[model samples]
Target: MYDALVVGAGPAGLMYSRVLAAKGFKVAVVEKNEQLAVKPCGEGISARVLKTAEIEKSDYNRFISHVIKGAVIVAPNGKEVIVKEEGEMGYVIDKKNFLRVMGEYSASTGAEIYMKEPVKELTFQKDHWLVKTRTMELEAKLLVGADGYLSFVSRTLGLEKPGERKVIPAIQYVMPNVDVHDPDMTYFFLGNDVAPKGYVWIFPKDGRLANVGIGVQGAAPKAYLDKFIKMHPEIFKKVDILEFRGAAVTIGGMLSEIVTDHAILIGEAAGQVIPLTGGGIHTSIAGGKIAAEVTAKALEEGNLSKQRLSEYKDKYNEYWGKRIKDSLKGLHAIEKLSDDELNQLAEILSPEDVVNLANGENVASVAVKLLKHPLFSIKLARALLS
Candidate 1:
C-alpha cells in the first residue's frame, strides 16, 4: 500500500507528493490530464507566493510589466486611482512553463507521477482507501483530493457541498500584441457594466501580451465575458487573441468538513481560492505543504484517523483562516458599493490602498482611507449604510 495517494497532479497535488516523498513516504500523484501545462488559469502569481513556495525566479520566463509598483483601479465612470505597494511587487508568470517546471521538479524529488489516469471511485475499507481508476485499483493509507472544484474525492468522501458562495465562474483569455504600457501594473475594472457582481482584470505577461479575464458571482460566465469584450472595443481593437479558457474558482472558502476518515481535501476542492481576487496558486501550494506535513505525521504515528487528520484543519485555520474571512468580508463591502461609488472609491485611494486591497487587507482599513476623500466617503457611506 502506498503511504499517500494524491488525486490530481495540479500544483497542489504535486506539491503534496513532493513534500511527502522528501519525507520518505511512498507518494503517488494521479492526474486526469495527459500532460502538465497551463491547463486553464489567469497566469499570474504574486511575488509573495512565489517566494513562499521557494520557486526560483529563474525557473519561470519573465515578462516584467510595471514592477507591479501597485495596482490601478478604473471605476465604471473611467476615473482611476493608483495604489503603491509596500514591498516587492508580484510577477506575471508564464503559466505553461511554470507548471512544466513544477512537474519536473516534483518528479526529480522521487514522487511517482501518473498522467491520464482519472480516478473513478474511492472506497474506504478497513483503515485504508481503495482507489479505482479505469484500468487499475490502488490502495493507500491516506488520500488527498486536490482535483479542482469538481472533486470526485470530495464527492466520494461525502463532504458537504462547498456552498453557492464558494463556487465562482471565471472566463479568461491571453491577448497578444496589445498596446498596453507598464505591464507590471495590474488593472481592475469595477461596475456591473463591466463585470456584474465580479470584476475584470488586465494582467500583463510581457511587452504586448496580457491575460484579460472577467469573473461573475453566481452567474453564467460566458455571457459576461462576451459583454466585457464587446464593451471594451477600444482595448480589443489593438489586441490579438492568443488563447481562451474558463473554469470555476472557489471563493467563499471551504466547507467545515475538509478532513475525515483517512481523506483530506486541498486546493480548489476545499474552496481555498481567494474570495475577491480568485487567486488560488498560493493557497493551493501552501495547503499542499500543510496537508503533506500532517499526513506524514499521521503516518509516522500509525494513525490516519479523522482525529489525526484534524491537524490539517487546525494548521490551515491557524495559517489562512483570518485571511480568508477578511477577504470574504471585503468582497461583501465591494459588492455593496454602487458602480459610481466604486469608481469614486478607486479614484480616491492611493496605490498603497490598491495593493492592500489586492493583498487581502482588512476592509475597515481600506474604508478609512477612502473616507479621507470627501466625495468617496459620502458615496461609500451612503452605499454601506443603505
Candidate 2:
C-alpha cells in the first residue's frame, strides 16, 4: 500500500506527489496521457505565485517562450489601456517543458508516476482507499483528486458543483508568420460581438507565432474568432494556420468543498481556478503544495479522519478563499457591464487597479480607488449591482 495515491499527472497532482515524496512518504501518481501537458491552455503563468511553488528560476527559464511585460486591454468600444510594470511581469511558457520539469522533479524525489493509467473507480475500506485503475487496484492511506473539472473521483464522491461554476467554451489558433504589434505584450479584446460574456486573447510565443484564442459563454466560438480576425486584418492577414485546438474552461471560481475525511481534491477538481482570467496555474501550484503539507501532517499524526483533512479547507480558506471570492465578484461585475460602461470603467482604472483586480484583489477596494474618478463610481455601482 502506498502512503498517498494521486489522480491526474497535471501540475497539481505532480506538485502534490513531489511534496509527499520529499516528506519521505510513498507516493503514486496516475495520469491518462502518454505525454504531459498536451491539452489546450493559455500557457500564461504569473511571477507572483511562482515564489509559492518554489520552482527554481534556472530550471524553468528554458521553458519561457516569451516574457510578457504588460497587457494591452481593449474595451468593448475599442478603447485601449496598457497595464504593465518595470522588468518582466509574466511568462508565456512552453507548457510541455514546464510539465516535464515538474515530472522529473517529482520522480527525482522518489515518486512513482504511472503514465497512461486512467483511474476507473475508488473504494474506501479498512482505513485505506482502494484506487481501481484501468489495469489493477492499489490501496493508499490518502487519496488526492487532481483530475480537473470533469473529475471522476469528485463525481464518485458526490461533491456538488459550486454555484460559481460557469463553463466557457474556448478555441485557439496557433498562427505562425503573424504580424504582431508587440511580442512583449499580451492583448485582450472585450465585447459581446467578439466574445459573448467572455474575452479574446492574443499571446505571442515568438516574433511571428502567436496563440490567437477566444473564450465565449455562448457556443459559437469559431464564429467569433472569424469575426475577430476580420476586424484585425493587419495582424492576422496572410498568416499560416499551424493548428487549431480548444477545450471547455471552468472559470467558476472555487468549489464549495475540496476535502473529505480521507479524500482531498486539488486544482480544477477543487474549482481553484481564477474566475476573471480563467488562469489556474498559480492557484494549482499553491493548492497542491498546501494540500501536500496538510496530508503530510495528517500522516505524521496517523489521523486520516475527514475532520482532520478538513484542515486543508481551513488553510485554503485562510489563504485564498477571500481572494477567489473577490475575483468572482469582479467576474460578475464584468458580466453585468455594458459595452459602453466597460469602456468607461477601463478608461478610468489605472494599470495598478487592473493589476490588483486581475491578481484577485478586493473589488470593494477597487471601488474605493474609483472615488478619485467620480464618473467611474456610478458605472462601477451599476456593474456591481447588476
Candidate 3:
C-alpha cells in the first residue's frame, strides 16, 4: 500500500506528489490523459503565484513570457482603463511545457506516475482505501482528489454535488497574427453585448500571438460566446484561429466538507477558483501544497479520521478561504453592474484603484470607488453601512 494515492496528474496532483515524495512518502499520481498539461485553460499565472510558489527563474525558459505589466479593461463604448503595477506583473505561460517541468520534478522526487490510466471508482477497505482503475486496483492509506471539474474522484468520494451555484462555462481559442496594441498588457471586455453575465479576455502570449476567450454563466455558453465574437469584427478581422477549446470553471467556492475518513479533495474538485475572476491555477497549486502538509502530519501522528483531516480545512481557511469569500462578494457586486454602469464606474476609478483591486488589496478602497458613482453610490453606501 502506498502512503498516498493522488488522482489526476495535473499541477495540483503533481505538486502534492512532489512535496509528499520529497518528505519520504510513497506516492503515486494517476492521470487519464496520455500527456500532461493538455487541459483547456487560459494559460495565465500571475507573478504573485510564481514568487509564492518558489518557482525558479531558470525553470521558466519557453514556459514563460516576461512582460511585466498589467491588464486593460475595455467597456462597451470603447472606453479603456489600463491598470498598471510594479514588480513582476504577470506571465503568459506555455502550460504544456510548464506541466512537463512539474511532472519531471515530481518524478525526480520518486513519485510514481501512471498515464492513460483513468480511475473508475474508489472504496474504503480495512485500514486502507482501494482505487479501482480499468485494469488494476491500487490500495493506499490516503487518497487525494486533484482532478479538475467533473472529477470522478470527487464523485466517488461523495463531494460532487455543487451547492447553491455551479461554475461558469468558458470558450477559448489561440489566435495568431492578432493586431493588439501593448502586447505586454492583458485586456478584458465587459458588457452584455460581449459576454452576457460574463467577460472576455485577450491575453498576449508573444508577438502577434494571443489567447482569446470568453466565459458565460448558465447554459448555452457557446451561444453567447458566438454572438460576442461575431459582434467584435474589428478585433477578430486580423486574427487567424490556431486552436479552439472550452471548459467549465468552478467558482461557487468549496463544499461544506472536502476531507472525509480517508479521502480529500483539492483544486477544482473542491471548488477553489476565485469567484470573481474564475482563476484557480494558483489556488489549486496552493491547495495541493496544503493538503500534502496536512496529510503528512496526519500520517506521522497515525491518525486519518475526518477530525484529523479537518486540518486541511483549517489551513485552507487560514490561508485562502477569506480571499475566496471576498472575491465572491466582489463577484456579486460586479454582477449587479450593467454595461452603462460599468463604463461610468470605470471613468470614476483611478489607475490606483484598479491596481488595488487586481492586486488583492483593500476591499474598502474598491467599494469606496464604486460608491463615488451616482447610480451605484446608494447601493454601495447601503453595503458599507450594513
Query: For residues 1-386, what per-residue lDDT tens digits would candidate 1 score against the true structure?
Result: 89989998877888888888989989888888887753567766667776656677676444324345556777889877775556856777766566667777778888888888999878888888899986779999999999888888887777755353366678888887654445657788878877878888888766677888888876777787777777777667767677888877777766667898888998877877778788888888888989998889899999988888999989987857556656665676677777877766665666666655655655567767767777756644333333
lDDT of each: 0.76, 0.83, 0.79
Q: Name model 3 segments beyond 4 Å from true.
A: 65-68, 162-165, 355-361, 371-374, 377-386
How many clashes in each structure?
Answer: 10, 1, 0
TM match of model 1 to true structure? 0.89
C-alpha lDDT of candidate 2 relative to the true structure: 0.83
Q: Which segments of candidate 1 are over 4 A away from where they belong?
A: 37-39, 62-69, 85-88, 162-165, 218-220, 367-386
Q: Output the lDDT of residue 22, model 1.
A: 88
Clashing pairs in 3: none
Q: Model 1: clashing residue pairs?
A: 65-183, 65-184, 66-183, 66-184, 82-351, 83-350, 83-351, 83-352, 84-351, 84-352
- TM-score-sorted candidate list, best first: 2, 3, 1
Q: Which candidate, 1 or 2, has the higher lDDT?
A: 2
Writing each residue's lDDT as its tens digit, candidate 2 over 212-301 gives 898888559999998889888888889877879988787877778778878899988888888888888888888888899999999999
